[model samples]
Target: MTILAELPTPAPTRAAAPVARPSFAARIRRAAPPYLYLAPALVLLVVWTYRPLAQAVRLSFHTWNLLPTSPITEVGLANYERLLSTPDLGASVWRTVLMVLGILPFSLVIPVVVGLVAARVRGRIYQAMIFAPMLVAPVAAAAVWQWLLDPGAGAVNRVLGVRANWLHDTDLALLTIIVVTGWHIVGFAVLVVSAGLSGINPDYADAAAMDGASRGRITRWITLPLLSPTMAFLVLMTVLLSAQWTFPLIDTLTQGGPSDATTNIYYLLWDYGFHSYDAGLGAAAGVIFFVGFGLIAVGVVALSDRVSHHDD
Candidate 1:
């Protein structure tokens, strides 16, 4: 009887209450604040940047004169074909390469040297003097160079005692543009490299000095390696944006003249769309350039990643 009573007297179990899932409205309520915060930026990006990009892509497949009255006629790959067939396009790309190469010494090498020197020099005024060019407006700088580079009666030609048309001559036009662009952009590079130099620990240099390392050796081994990341950034920026940096100078000075000698891909695109009124061709070129540059940028980043040594 005791065993039967004990077996029968098991405590009654209560049924578990089911957990409630959040409703769609509750989920939306929880997410509302972040979305609200992001709304303005998202709207602006969609309206200004993404929308124009999408429109350009769409327009690339169609012929458009950019006139409101003109109907957009779908031409499939014709615009791309035309771009490929253009002789100037190929030449423009090569000139662009040369431009980047020409600018590299000024933008990367010279600035680095100047920055290193500036670091050793104990004056903020010296640093400011180096960076003054960057503060000037591009158009204003171009106008000033326009006067200085004049073939006849210009200061440069007068000083050199040569009546050389610096900007108008075919052989000299592109090179002249490169030099001007470099002058304009070098100051910015100096500022950037100087900032990088400032961040490097003096202890490294001190330690190397104590170890009997020469100043040159210290710079070569310690300073440069630590500054690799900054150098890489400058290199990448110079390569990718060289065309853009030269645009204002090209517009104001050359206008893509002297047999299109100074016309890089950037100018070519602008010439097609604005000057030639071939929006479709310009859009096609834009798409190709965008893709090509994007790939280049990715490759550069990868290479920089492998080469750059983070002090951290």
Candidate 2:
């Protein structure tokens, strides 16, 4: 009776079992499906894009006519040397810059205005009409424009009562190409801008209106800031891919002719590779353009990221 109650023996605490990590093979098995899905695209990219790019770089160091019968002779930067030496290279670059500048009004400014108008109007038919040009095939559109710009029996001349050879005159040819390319591109830009506008929250405009903001002020501060991302994208596309966009029209209508007024780096590369049968020169130009444009594209994206407003 006097004995103290025996202290209950402490129950043995079971240690928590360590969680086992998955085996390497198990992790790989889990990842296999995604990689397998990506494999086809990776293979195609290597086969078509990267392989050709690598071949072009290799060919830039050699002289070849792109003919099976022609042997590739190592030239060791001669192609690049010749490219740098060409006097027209400077002029071509200047013209390319001019072409981009010329197209900017139609591609960016006008399209933005039109898109704003369309957004207010909300007319599907009008939007369809505006976007119709984008649906036309580039070559076909070029062909049609060639007819329209003809000095004789052309709709443009007939309408204006001017007999200017829009695609033949050295001064007019490049301008004509820019106009045609812009016409094709503007519709796409309009559509893009319209879509962007549609995606914006209406509350911003309503809030600005409640604050007695003018329509112009609302657009300048609210609308444009929200649309800045889309606008930046449009600018990037217009600047970087402008040459390719104008290529078909130039090839079909001008063929880089009328004193090469419309010839851009893209056209020059084509002229060297196919027309002049100078594979090394073409490859060298391609490599140079690729590097230059790649850098320019990076700069544009970086600038856009900094400049564009992302907040709602």
Candidate 3:
């Protein structure tokens, strides 16, 4: 008798189960994980930025020092009206405007040109040397200028063989302030413009060159247009933060002085807030300052977007 092996039977298969489809809300919830991760930052932004803005708006409407003992007077727009009529207020606003204009061209045009030219520089040495001034603190830069413009110990007068007082002269004081501020921020501007230039597709410039376009022609038609967004952002930032960026130098070096020639709205607010112990006045000034700059910045960026067309 021979032993025989039994053949195995095939297992029966079951019907395929339906694929589970996510509902609209469930999909949204799943997609929301990234935003949920951002919740801490969102909360911080609201706390630091919006909370003060909201409080400032309410405080601006009333004449309150925001001190414990001080009473809040409901003088709707009185503080604003008072801010408008103050004599030095006009000067502060005007000086701020002038600084914006002075800084805009210096920060926007000069650095961009320098950065472009530096891109073609032979070595890293030259590039670093040119960008060095921007690494210095604004206060330190101003102090250096103060020494240079000393009219006594400063080498500027000695080199030029002139005894003219730089700080004593009110007419020159504001201009000097601009120069000091510009030197401090020049490196940053150069860095931003250089990054923008580096990001530009060299292919466009190459194509333009192939078409017999001059260096200047390619720069004017191709390079500059693409750089508009970066320029626009810088302009907006300089406009919105004109005082904060430059005022510290003025505060530390000049104290807005010689005769208030360099005094900006920030200086005015600071004087009132700290020196005069009048937080109500300072708060009013702060509100006025914020609103004016905010409006101007909004207008500039809005206008820029209308005129600009960026390539992807």
Best by TM-score: 1
Better of 1 and 2 by TM-score: 1
- Model 3: per-residue lDDT, tens digit, 1-312? 001113477975855634798788987986798799999999999999989877777777777654789788877877778778989899988999899898887789897888778777755676577679877877777788889999888998999999878766888888888877787777678778887778788999999999999999988898889888777777877777778888878887778888898898888888877786555567778777777777886698678777654757
- Between prediction 2 and prediction 3, which has the larger lDDT? 2
- C-alpha lDDT of residue 308 in model 1: 91
lDDT for 28 (candidate 3)? 94
What overall lDDT, based on C-alpha atoms, would model 3 receive against the true structure? 0.79
lDDT order, best first, reads: 1, 2, 3
Clashes of each: 0, 0, 0
- Check candidate 1 and list the clashing pairs: none
Off by more than 4 A, model 2? 1-28
Task: Residues 144-230, candidate 1: write the lDDT tens digits.
Answer: 998998888699999999998999999999999999998888878988898888889889999999999999999999999999989
Candidate 2 lDDT over 1-312, as tens digits, reads: 001214569986866634897788986986698789999999999999999999999999999987899899999989999989987677787888998898888778987788777777758888788789988998899878878888898999999999999988998998888888888888888888887888889998999899999999998999899988888888888888789899988899999998888888888888887888888988998999899998988898889879988764
Root-mean-square deviation of every model: 13.5, 13.4, 14.0
> How do all the candidates rank in terms of TM-score, highest first?
1, 2, 3
Which numbered prediction scores highest in lDDT against the true structure? 1
lDDT of each: 0.89, 0.86, 0.79
Query: Pairing residues by index, what is the TM-score of model 2?
Result: 0.89
